[model samples]
Target: MTFGEKIFKYYQQINVPQDLPTGVEVLYPFDSTEVADLTRSFYMRYFNDKRPRTFLIGINPGRFGGGSTGIPFTDPKILEEKLQIPNTLDKRHELSSRFVYQMIDALGGPEKFYDSFYFTSVCPLGFVRDGKNLNYYDDKALEEALEEYMAGEMRKQLDFGGNEIAFSLGMGKNIKFLKEFNRRHNLFKEIRPLPHPRWIMQYRLKRLDEFIGVYRETLAPFMPDFHK
Candidate 1:
């Protein structure tokens, strides 16, 4: 199977993990027909090849972004505008999505960028606490409970084929978590951390270009040669 085929099947077969502690609800987006279809279409469009692409792992999907569209960092608006994949999901734009696509544009747009990289998360699934998006590591108990599950998923994705070096989407806790995860499981050669797009858009809005430049340089070594 191609890289995209494996991903599409994994998501389609995912069931909400049972007995997630009280107050924490799973954000299982694949159950909906629209989200599942959009996910399949997007993966097939860009990732049908047998080539291996390094995975850029994020914390988890936020409510307004991947949680609704089933594609990491892609909000509904981006799904329609940038990807040209029409969807019934709300058209609300996410700051992270804006920053990611801007960097994608800098790296020569979606087709070129996606040729070598795929965005995902430590936990392919996400959770919500009190109706607000929650990171997997937000609660100590939840984090511990999900460790084996996260590692198992990571191993499964790696077996599908990718680079030895992985990229962590957040420079803070998310990186810390992934680093420790690697230390324990020996998952990658190295896990490089990138500044979280949400943090940058929320705090460093004026310096967006600088961060995008950082992303371009950090990812340059892995990018494949392609015509402009």
Candidate 2:
């Protein structure tokens, strides 16, 4: 099987629990093509295609984002309705799923981008807090447990990959994790930092053009041939 298919198949077997199902208390577990797509991107870049030159990383899966769509920063509603990908979920009330779907539209759709670049996260599981689905900061114990799993598995899959440039969304904890991953394992040649698209769309719509402008530049040197 191809690398992408292999990763997708493996995703089908993963069984993380959905502790938070509603309000802010739902920690939806990972599942489906959204997870399959992101994880497959990691392996396909280096193993199958060997042509992907860039990698973008997020902190972890949000209940509505990766947790539901399986694709990082993906919106559940659009992912199902527009992208024709079944969500298999409707959890996490405060997630940015809708916003993410809009972002994909603004960025020229999924087929345009997923053809080349890749998106992923430091931690793959969803997190929650005192009756609230917190962002990456809610479940320390869960984070630690998943960290080992992600790293160990990625090491096997991404081992000594080529000169792929890496980018991280948001800052603080996510950057710290990427730094540690780079230092410990040297996954990519270099890693750049970018503000999460959610942050830009949330408080800085006017600045979104500028943000996308920068993203265009970053993606310029690494655009992939969708025709292939």
Candidate 3:
């Protein structure tokens, strides 16, 4: 089967919970042909034959971005209006997403990042409280929920075939998850950690360059062709 077909089938196989106390949202951007148009237009290009052997995994989907658009860290305004990326999921709010977009823009935007890297999550689904999203760590049932999620990730990774490095978006949970995976299978060349862009933006905007400097150092061997 083709790569896209593998991903599409994987999406169908996952046992996403339909209902929960507040709600369980699993946004599948690649489900329908219409939505997959955007998936093809934007995300598909990020994982072509020439794409880099790196994976950028987040803790989970945020409400407005992945939760709403079904694409990791994708902002609704940017996806719908700017990139003309279509979405079937309803609109919502996400704060860290904009900062992530900004950082990507600074790092030469999607065209550049996607050329070498693809983004995803430890958990593809979104968790909500009264209505507001509770971050991955905030969810009380995350430990059990995440084990199931990691199984799905391993499946996707196996489909992708060869990945040299796995970059966790934050120094917290994503790192913990990936490190454990590395130990279990020895499947990755290296798994690196960086502070979440949200934390960088909110707490150290002035030191953005420094934070990115550290990140670059970690990624140096893999990003040899990238411009400084």
Off by over 4 Å in 2: 15-53, 86-108, 137-147, 156-163, 224-228
RMSD to the native, candidate 3?
A: 3.7
Residue pairs in collision within model 1? none
Ordered from best to worst TM-score, the candidate numbers read: 1, 3, 2
Q: How close to the true structure is residue 195 of candidate 2, measured as C-alpha lDDT?
A: 73
List, residue by residue over 1-228, the lDDT tens digit for candidate 1: 998998898889764556567899888888899998899999999989888889899998899998889899999999999999998888999999999999999988898889899898998888899999998888998888888888888788887678998999999999998999999999999999999999999999999999999999989778867443
Model 1, position 169, has a per-residue lDDT of 96
Q: What is the lDDT of every predicted structure here?
A: 0.89, 0.57, 0.63
On lDDT, the candidate that comes out on top is 1
Error of 3 at 153 (Å): 3.1
For candidate 2, write residues 5-122 as lDDT tens digits: 5545545565453333344443444444455654455445433633433457777666556665565666556555766655455634323445444544555666566555556666
Give candidate 3 regions above 4 Å deviation.
1-9, 12-14, 17-34, 50-52, 80-93, 185-189
Q: Please write out the lDDT profile of model 3 over residues 88-114, one tens digit for every residue.
A: 545554556766666666566666655
Measured against the true structure, the TM-scores of the candidates, in listed sequence, are 0.97, 0.70, 0.76
